[model samples]
Target: MNANMRAAAPTEVLRYTAFSADPDGGNPAGVVLDASALDDAARLAVAAEVGYSETAFLTPAPQGTEGAPEGRAFTTRYFSPLAEVAFCGHATIATAVALGERIGPGELLFLTPAGPIPVTVVGGDGESGPRATLSSVEPHSEPVEDKDLTEALAALGWARGDLDPEIPPRIAFGGNDHLVLAVTSRERLGALDYDFERLKELMLRLGLTTLQLVWRESAGVFHVRDPFPVGGVREDPATGAAAAAFGGYARELGIVPEESRFTLHQGEDMGRPGELTVDLRAGDPRVHVSGTAARIG
Candidate 1:
């Protein structure tokens, strides 16, 4: 693999862990703070070398691309180890927090292929570390056909009875697309052995970012696992994009109140436990996901 980042401008790659205060507890992402001169190939090479599920490339907003001021707003792109993706939440959070440390905590706009995203960074007090919250694009969910659900279950090695009847399968979109599958029990959710190639083919055909496997723990707490085959990763420790999509799915399906807040526990099965806070407002269709990030050496 060509794993090299070469360009004229400064191309420092910052490493950080998103969705947890501990460096080893959350999803790790590579953040390129200034990638103005890097081409797509160079960015991809850098991401491959970083060996993270996703790496974010940031540059100043180009002229006439959007109304964003040159230095204030950024044009961002996300690349996995294999290819580029429309959006990636964990990397976005890591990038936001990295920018926050340099520019001070505030709001920053990122122009992504999915759309314009608004991210707010808050400085941490003595009690907590720096955190970032991203508001997703208008989210929507569509019913999943029986055939698709059946095929997905087969790839996941799960039977129909293992699924949670209350939360039906659906395709949810919050910046990126995700297949939301709710399991009946935590045990069922924990045993995740899937046909990677088969699932990757299905996801590629359907343009899905990840399979959001979930189990509702209580009224507001849930456990989630994301199988990201297309990204060249077996599983994502903490998936903020999937969490946002799942929040939208839960709200639209009436599983939760229109205006509600929920907690998602993820990566525990993988030993990198993370906590993501999801919020859904009554009037707004967008989903908000919040998590802390820490720099990693």
Candidate 2:
């Protein structure tokens, strides 16, 4: 270990659940408000200790960095138990709400490895607590290769005929890459059994963070689940990043109107139900994901 790693100061890690008002409903995330004294190794250690799917570490941004106003801009990094990811939606929302409690709700800028993310927090003092809306970077989707899709289905123990033909398989990118797969029935979606090692290998090989397993309930309502073996977690209760990527995928594929809003209900199968709201504007390519978070002891 290096000198900095050895002498790392203890930091306070705040626990909060994102995408739901109830702490027990959403995805739990660890937030390190000030990670200035910790190095990369120390940060990862904290995340592993917290044992959530992901954690957010915030350090002060460099002076005069664009879009980073004083006292509100931060260079944030997301780390899973196994590795550092480019971006994490739930952690970002959790961190924003945590900051909102301390600094009041409004706009905050986070410089992430993926890109600059703009987050807005509102109604912190209300009965529901703070709700955060994160505007993702420009998003795009592309068709997945035949071989890769076949391999994914096999690892998932799903047949090709089980897929929803309306939404073709595609790799979508908002903050990170997720393979979007829409199923024909909610029963298929709930029966979450997969070969963890095999799926993790495929995800790591394809630079995928999670597989966005979804079942469309209506034109604007959907039930979603994410298999996140790559993050050392079998499933992510509520995945903000995947939700944002799915929004882009829906818009790009014309599954929904150019300007539309949709609801994604996740974590129900895990007994931790959470709701995510995704909005797409007519002229804007970026997707907006909004949800409420609550502090967890």
Candidate 3:
């Protein structure tokens, strides 16, 4: 029975959520451990097989099959039901936790299209599943021009006055580019009426991946909503990558204190609430977004 035991389950596919514990609480993702066995079409079929928005396909780990405790990591690729993305934060989180369950949780390194990301699996507890936090690659942000800002505002049907003076407009990047627009009023953030097609077109034209609409509730806390027209979704519930990017943007532009740790509350308006915590170090460029996930049945 021990010799007959296979390392991987027959299904080879696992489902988990990012940023929350409840099954219905967070972003769902599909994970495939040994996608090397499947061709592109087969892998894609497997992704569509799971029917999640995005699924992660992993390449065979490395020359050294470095076992658990310090768990094995591999090159990871993300694909939506439609197409591939440079990266997906939620899927990365889900995949990390899945691997942790098998390898017994420690440091797992993922070589992503964007770069190498390090994930630490903090092992499971009595009733709780394992938790993993991935530190993003060198994060950075740039100023969004006035002209482009106007167009973005137009696409979202949001006026300039709606923006918060403290947190100005900026384009941020962790693995993907997101235009961070801060709204002054919570009402404006809650009233998320936007031109879907128009925003999508604008995003494509500008090479933007998502629009990070944020309403700062306080110095250490914020309410965030992401408009992801490019991903073919109206919004992302909890965006770990975007939160990491925002941490960089805020720190660089003096929007927040030099070394500040903050919490972002998102998807409340959509009713699938999630929380993200971003920790910023004084000299380090890597942004860390931490959250726990649960299996979504």
Candidate 4:
């Protein structure tokens, strides 16, 4: 792996979690610290080899000083195994913690393709180690088209009667756009079965990043499972992108307090459990998603 990453053409994958401390928890991501040297094909190849849901690529800031820039900032781009993604929150968290390891815990300013994302890394060493929290870009939500909503439900093998009317469907954007669909029951959320190719096709046509399937467990808590066929994944355990989108969706619909902190549990059915904390500011539209990520290996 070192040879692959440092042999004139450097591209190595460093594993880290996105939303939890335990390696078994959180969303896993691959990080390539020096992607500045690689071309698009090389970078994509490296990501495909690394095999995480997504990988973060770091390049010299288009406009900034070298050697970690001001406030540990750098330009970043994210890519899945198959294609490039505009932004990825889980990968942002993973890369922040990875940077923290090399430079010691502190704040990292990630100049993402979507926008500038600031991440703070705190805690680390032996039994106790570093964890990261990322504040997302400004979030916003819009009403879901009735016809589109019905199509989405049919795609997921769900019924209109099974939806939570209060949360109202919406297409929300935090970093990337996500379709927020709230199921009336946890059982409906858990019994996920969809034609992968069909969903992928539909998502591509709609320019969607993922499908946020959720069930509100309480006023300030929710359970989520994301169908990411768009990214060639069946289900995502913990999705920081969707969490941010969901936060915006909830607030836009007056379902939760304007400034509130909430919990999201995902991946229980798949058995790789993860917990994500979503924080909304009183006047800010950007939702902050917090979690601790450990090395997958």
Candidate 5:
């Protein structure tokens, strides 16, 4: 065996679905409670073996890490079938729920590559499983370059007229960067046929993790879809990172009030429906994404 392979220790990986209480719904993610002995190659291998879009690996954080409670802090990393990403929302939620089941629901801290993420876990009573709320790091948005936007649209086979002029196009950042494009109608949003290689090239050049395609249903509700070619997944059922970034984008552009709560419906087109709740506080620039998760038997 190779040195890297030999260095990997057999660790227990928990499988869970985030953003939905039903196991068949939501996005499935693999969570490793103790990956301290696993190397990058090992982690990648595990993620590929699990066949999920993303998997979270957790190692105990150093004692007294800032903002972390004495026994509830962990250093976390995310890996997809193809590569390691700076952050992943669904995987984070799945990991938190898995931890909650073992340690009892409470406040927990995760030191991720993007930044420190504070998560609160509650419930696990009766039939409903544990729910987790993760507060993202400060979010921001920047205008999408004209050339990049054009290229992106071309990859998706979409015309400029199909875009929602009200929302505009922007590159938003929560934990990872995402290209936000609001479609004019739900029909246009549902017809998501994109050139995989072309979009992947554009995403890599722009340092984007996914394309957050959205269609507003009402003042506080929207249907969202994420094409994650960069992560080697065709689509993400429920994307927490993109939801957080979208909240920031909306607040930054005044599409929503300073303090507002919104619901994001995702994965419906893929048949695995899930819901994500986004909360924007008046004074805090950070976005909070909350959802429920259940173990997949």
Candidate 6:
């Protein structure tokens, strides 16, 4: 059998919601604990069947994949219903918490396409579930080209005047590229009606993972929405990757001070209502995102 199609039997896939203790809230991800025997095709098939925004597949370290040890480390890959993503923050958090439940919480390393991501999972108390914090790869943001920005705004059904003059448009990267567009009011952020296919086309052309639609509620609080047409999801309830990227953007823009921590409210409009915490250290460039997750099924 071709390696990509070789599979002995069906593997167990766990369902978990990331960034929320309540099973009905947060972003749901399908977790395959042992995918060593499955090939790319099989993984894709599994993700499609699960029908989550993203599904995480964990396999023993493959040749050329390095980090930690045999049992302590794994090569993790994320797949959406339609395609594979370089990294997925919510899925990573969910996977870590799931592993913590089985192996006892501590530190877990993932060898991902983006790079090695270090995740720390805290064991859950009886009442509340486990929480995981994942430190992103070094983050960076750059000015969005005027033409690209214009195209994005048009696709979002937004005009240049609709944006917050303070938070200029930028392309930010934590693990994946996200176009960060900050609006002047929460009303604007909540009223999200866009040209889906047009936005998807532009995102695919620019290699964007999601459009980070944001509104600043206060100095330390914000509301965020992610448009993830590229991933075959209209919107993600809670997006850890975009949160990290936005944290980097805010710090770089001096909108928030260094060594700052903030709360992000997401999925409110969709009724999922998940919360994510983002932290930045004085000197460290990488962003940290923390949230709690629970098993759904």
lDDT against the true structure, per candidate, is 0.92, 0.94, 0.82, 0.83, 0.94, 0.92
What value does the lDDT take at residue 215 in candidate 1?
95
Query: Candidate 6's residue-wise lDDT over 249-286, tens digit each?
Result: 89988989989999999999998989999999998988
- How do all models score by TM-score? 0.94, 0.96, 0.90, 0.93, 0.96, 0.94
In candidate 2, how many Å is residue 235 off? 0.0
Residue-level lDDT for 238 in candidate 2: 97
Steric overlap count per candidate: 0, 0, 0, 5, 0, 0
Q: Candidate 2 on 27-131: residue-level lDDT in tens? A: 999999999988899989999999999999999888898877679999999999999999999999999999989998889999999999999999855677999
Give the C-alpha lDDT of model 5.
Answer: 0.94
Which segments of candidate 1 are over 4 A away from where they belong?
A: 1-10, 63-70
Deviating ranges (above 4 Å) for candidate 5: 1-9
In terms of lDDT, which candidate is stronger, 2 or 6? 2
Q: How much does candidate 1 score in TM-score?
A: 0.94
lDDT score of model 4? 0.83
> Across residues 78-108, which tens digit of lDDT does each residue of candidate 1 receive?
9999999999999999999999899888888
The digit string of per-residue lDDT tens for model 4 on 1-297 reads 765575473557799877777888778899988887788898788787887778999976765444345657788998888899988988888888888889888878888878888788887656647777787888888877888887888788888999888877889999999998888998888889998887787789778999988899898788999988877678877888888888888888789899899999987887778888888889887888887778888
Off by over 4 Å in 2: 1-8
lDDT of 5 by residue, 1-297 (tens): 766575534678899999999999999999999998889999999999998999999999988797887788999999999999998999999999998888888999999999999999997667768889999999999999999999999999999999999999999999999999999899999999999999999999999999999999998999999999988999999999999999999999999999999999999999999999999999998999999998999
In candidate 5, position 36 carries an lDDT of: 83
Clashing pairs in 3: none
